[model samples]
Target: MHHHDNPPQSVPSSPAYIRATWGGTGSVEEASAAFGFSRAKGYDLVRRGEFPCRVLRIGRSTRVVTASLLRVLDSGEPEYSGTRDAHTAPA
Candidate 1:
């Protein structure tokens, strides 16, 4: 018989992990996880223009600005300015 004695590792916060891995930008999924939101809900928020920060649309790709995410995390208030580019399109 053999016994396993490995301890469980502590999980890092979503925002911290996203910031470390993605640097200045991250996907909407990452942003949603950072704020403890479901991926579906996150997409819904973006679609309804109710996301906490500005969501950028590049082609079919959607990315969240890390600066804005960090700001909202710090201040607990959204600062969206409704700056959608011509190329902006929903995912």
Candidate 2:
């Protein structure tokens, strides 16, 4: 008989779960997963400075503002204007 060393990985949580659990804000990974994006792709977007929503970088941690995400979801338009300065974190 074949033996498995590791168990199957659990499925990623849904957007509704992230919204319900995180409320007004969430990690970039969670937001990306909610939008059906892989964590690597999400971070890649942030690294390339091409993320379409408001991303706040607190030290090394990145958060996605739910209000801005909601706005994008509602209007189907990204708030980014191709300006790196626009993505600066608050002081």
User: In TM-score terms, which candidate is top?
Assistant: 1
Model 1 misplacement above 4 A: 1-14, 81-91
Clashes of each: 0, 0
Candidate 2 ranges with C-alpha deviation above 4 Å: 1-19, 81-91
Q: What digit string (tens of lDDT, one per residue) describes model 2 on residues 1-91?
A: 8878887544445444445566767788876776668889988887766666788887888888887776666677876523667655543
Per-prediction TM-score, please?
Answer: 0.70, 0.64
User: What overall lDDT goes with each candidate model?
Assistant: 0.75, 0.70
Model 2: pairs clashing at backbone N, Cα or C within 3 Å: none
Per-residue alpha-carbon lDDT of candidate 1 for residues 1-91, written as tens digits (9 for 90 to 100): 8666875443443455556667777888878877889999989887777789877878998788898987898789996634454555555
* Residue 87 shift from truth in candidate 1, angstroms: 15
Give lDDT: candidate 2, residue 26: 78
TM-score, candidate 2, is: 0.64
How displaced is residue 71 in candidate 2, in Å? 1.2
Give Cα distance to truth, residue 49, candidate 2, Å. 1.5
In model 2, how large is the Cα lDDT of residue 87? 56
**Model 2, residue 20: C-alpha shift (Å):** 3.3
